[model samples]
Target: MAKLPNGLISFGKNANCTLELCPLEASILQYQPSIPGNGAIIGLFALSMLIHIIQGVRWRSWDFMICMVIGCVDEIIGYVGRIMLHSNPFSFAAFVIQVVCITTAPVFFCSAIYVMLSRTINYLDRSLSHFNPKFFVWFFIPIDIVSLILQAAGGALSATQSGSGNKLGVRISMAGLILQVVTLVIFVALFIDYVVRYVRKSTARPLQSRMKLFLSFLFLSIVFVLVRCIYRIDELRDGYDGPLIRNEPLFMVLEAAMMVIAVFCLNVGHPGIVFDREPRNDAEMSYTYTGNTGAMLQPKLPSSSSE
Candidate 1:
């Protein structure tokens, strides 16, 4: 009876036309459709990100904060893209915005997490770690940049070109995601190895001090980010039309929630908490202990015998 909007098909607009239509996106509900996740909520994520930035600055956790901020910025823009989709799902610009921003955001966050471990290695005891302090920062960060490039480029291609022209984009994005997953897995393993050895060795130290908590915090941060990355890989596995791509609820929890939690974890798991190491003063301490009879001494409270 009524003419539908272009590609509206009860999804919203031509761009939202799905392979399947639900009661929500169906005929009647179209008149009073459910609001998609957008705006205030995205603003909330942005706010969370902003807070992390503040905390990062205050705490001087430069590495951790940068990672969280990048992820949050990606999310804020990604959700804004979704907002665009809600307005006109058929809008190519909106689709491209979301794809490019969201897909590549986590890479920065992961890189940040990787660097935290470098700080942790220093805090724990550099000698025991298999790699040098520079290894963590130099090795993985470049790799992370590579992944970001591939993903951003892929998403750009996919957004601009429709048909099979985008196939390369999809494949490239997949490659980036896969590489990121692998990188994080390797990082997690190395992190665990470092921690295990530290614990075993620490058993010999005085139990009075509890520095292991720093390591524990670092571990939690890693796990949260790793789990979030896994979810993203799955979501992107089948491309945009895939099952996970459309599932908003799962995305909220596994993706958004996990990342927020991970950022906060990094806050708690910061390295400065333990690495407040005082400089070793062998020469000064030795001098103090051996008393330089030739030079100067506190005139030995000269009063004792005379008094």
Candidate 2:
């Protein structure tokens, strides 16, 4: 097989200098990828995507379901790339697919969450929120788009420059992850503030049980994603050859497991639960806040057709 002039490991062909000649330090996949772990994640994401499809169709939640399906599909492809690494650790294609797909998958999930929150605000009293429901969708989705672009670009750079001792790619990826974390924190703060304001200021109106469950699971999913993002920032901060990057088990737990759990949580917290009924027209949907009691009039109940 043809080899590098400087004794560098030759790829796409077998040689005596296979894994033996290449030290673990020089290779990103120091150990063969965990077959069981990667396989399990792939299966989970596939199942999640199927479930999301069924639910989306059943509930007619097209946009939210589309976002969720995209995220799950990305995760599945990423794990399949990991499975490829198990067979050929030196496969550059596998590395690029896993890095780019997995790093940017959460952007879709974030979009779904942002849309749900905006709808939730419209479903509830819009007056309680700091901005209009459309504001959340327009503002945060662009931020998420920016973050996704940065992460994808960084992953591509890192993958192309793998084993070249390049720190620039790592820095770019770190910047993307850092921006994601910051954006999520701000989102959580806004979500919590709106909820608190809604609870404290509104008059006691009978709230649906499904609404309660929806909020609970949505909150849980956000927390899970936030935790995963933080872990990623730490892992990427020291570059690909860092100690944290080498630990396959840690990655399985923090990255794969966290995202799987988060998406499943979204399944449970599907927006359909609260948004099952058709929304009223803008005129009937408007709420008038009463300053005398710090309360707003309740929204009109759904029509029989909606039920």
Point to the candidate with the largest lDDT: 2
| Residue 263 in candidate 2, Cα distance off native in Å | 0.3
lDDT of each: 0.64, 0.77
**Candidate 2 colliding pairs:** none
TM-score of each: 0.73, 0.85
**Residue 87 CA error for candidate 2 (Å)?**
1.0
Q: Write the per-residue lDDT of candidate 2 for residues 1-307, one digit (tens) a residue.
A: 2334455663323322345556444456577788998998989999889999998988778888889999998888888898987766777778788889999998899888877667776666677888877888888889899889888888888767644534677777778888888888888899889878877864623356777888998989888898888998898877775788789989988898889999999999887776764333345553432221122334555456843
List model 1 lDDT by residue over 119-235, tens digit each. 655543578888886788888999999999988998887666555756677778878878887888898899888777876884323211324665676667667767876787776
lDDT minimum window of 10 residues, candidate 2:
288-297
The regions of model 2 sitting more than 4 angstroms off are 1-6, 10-17, 20-26, 162-165, 278-307
